[model samples]
Target: MANTTALLFFSLAAFAACSPSTCTFIPSTNATTTNYPGSSFIKTSAYPYNISVLSEVPIATICTSPTGNRTAELACARIYIDAIDEQLAFLYARRLGYAAVAGASKFATNTSLNDPSRNDVVAAGMAAKVLKYGATEAAGAVMGGEGCMIYAALKYEVETIQEECNNKFTVDVERVCK
Candidate 1:
């Protein structure tokens, strides 16, 4: 009876520890609530970006890896940066495409992009560091082809800010591009 109880306890503990459903990425409280002058753009665009990235980069795979903690940290940073990129896209669209005077005024006044203390900026810095680590790791080992290539490209895109999260919040390119 004692041995059976111990076995059950260990089994339950292992299940709790390994459950993928328990793992989730939550944004920083400040990032979630930040209300910049033109924050509506960010609020609208962030969800799809989060969903797209989350789908492309399987949380279970990253969360279960030996370096799971680092990978999960990078994932969170990627989500936050994607949100911020939405704001930047809105600013650019408003300025160059729509010629909105209000957007220009907001862009001139909004200092969040340059402020190192802002949640988005802090998250970007963290993402950059982790991506460098991931790229190094990728280069050192065999990544098993397409999945590994996708991860590498994601790190590159995050590092370069080449793929901005626009109004579309599309990750189609990230999914298919090699």
Candidate 2:
């Protein structure tokens, strides 16, 4: 329960940290996305993640308590991971497009990953491993005292997704984004 709660909190924080440039797609204009005046647009912090199969993920309830539903709970977490991954991928795609039209670091907070020694980056790596092996085991991936790890996974996944989207988009990210 505590772990899932932490994961939710950190995930929200991570999303807020990285979701500015790609919050909403402006129709018919690649050159203009949303220029959030001041800091960043935190649209996703409260927006629904749009998980398909399950309606609402009661992370505290079905995640780890009442060992009888372990299988379902684990499945629930894995599904959440996938959904979160998809959202991250989508955010990456849009951010790439926004960066192309806008500058590389216009709306992004700490866009540079130069400082590999950063604690968040290291913990995100740990989160990555948790995500990697969590595919099957899934205990630490979704349950237990791994909220920060899960949040890191989401955080680091943004970088990876951004690179992938850059390679895949960039050329027409501006035009095609419309």
Candidate 3:
């Protein structure tokens, strides 16, 4: 009886040690000041990475200008898009690390590989939330019809990041783990 109890305790301890680690995605925050007055509409800091994106024209001006200036509109889009790209890249790397841990745990225990779709779902969801929040913030800063351009650009950027998330976590995780 004592030997069986000892074996049971050991199994529980080993299982606890082998549990998978959790992955978290924290969204970036907007900074209050822009170095150039008219250059950027929104400035955000990608924490831990020390990266930031700044718009070229004040978002209000871009929205209110009678003639839709493609140059200014693209410039504003570029900053937020760039920020989204950087943030996604950071999150991807972190997700890869988590996948590696899970993979290693499976291998150590001689367990069948678990489906990676779960991780992909989580990564994609987080990426969508981050990009959407950034876009919403940018659109909120402009009044009336002016926000259309920003929204359009943001939509494209979001699609691009979502694709990237699918490729990175879904496809890449399998390759890395195998």
Q: Highest lDDT, which number?
A: 2
Compared with the true structure, all predictions reach lDDT values of 0.38, 0.42, 0.40
Per-residue lDDT over 69-123 for candidate 2, one digit per residue giving the tens place of the 0 to 100 score:
7778778677556655655454445544543333334223425322233433444
Q: What is the Cα-based TM-score of model 1?
A: 0.21
Return whichever of 1 and 3 wins on TM-score: 3
Q: By the lDDT metric, which is better: model 2 or model 3? A: 2
lDDT of 2: 0.42
lDDT per residue, candidate 1, 108-177, as tens digits?
A: 3432222213323434454455566565433322232223333333333332221221122222322221
All candidates: TM-score: 0.21, 0.28, 0.34
TM-score of 3: 0.34
List candidate 3 segments past 4 Å from native: 1-66, 116-178
Give all candidate RMSDs, comma-separated.
Answer: 24.4, 20.2, 14.3
Candidate 2, which segments miss by more than 4 Å at Cα?
1-61, 102-178
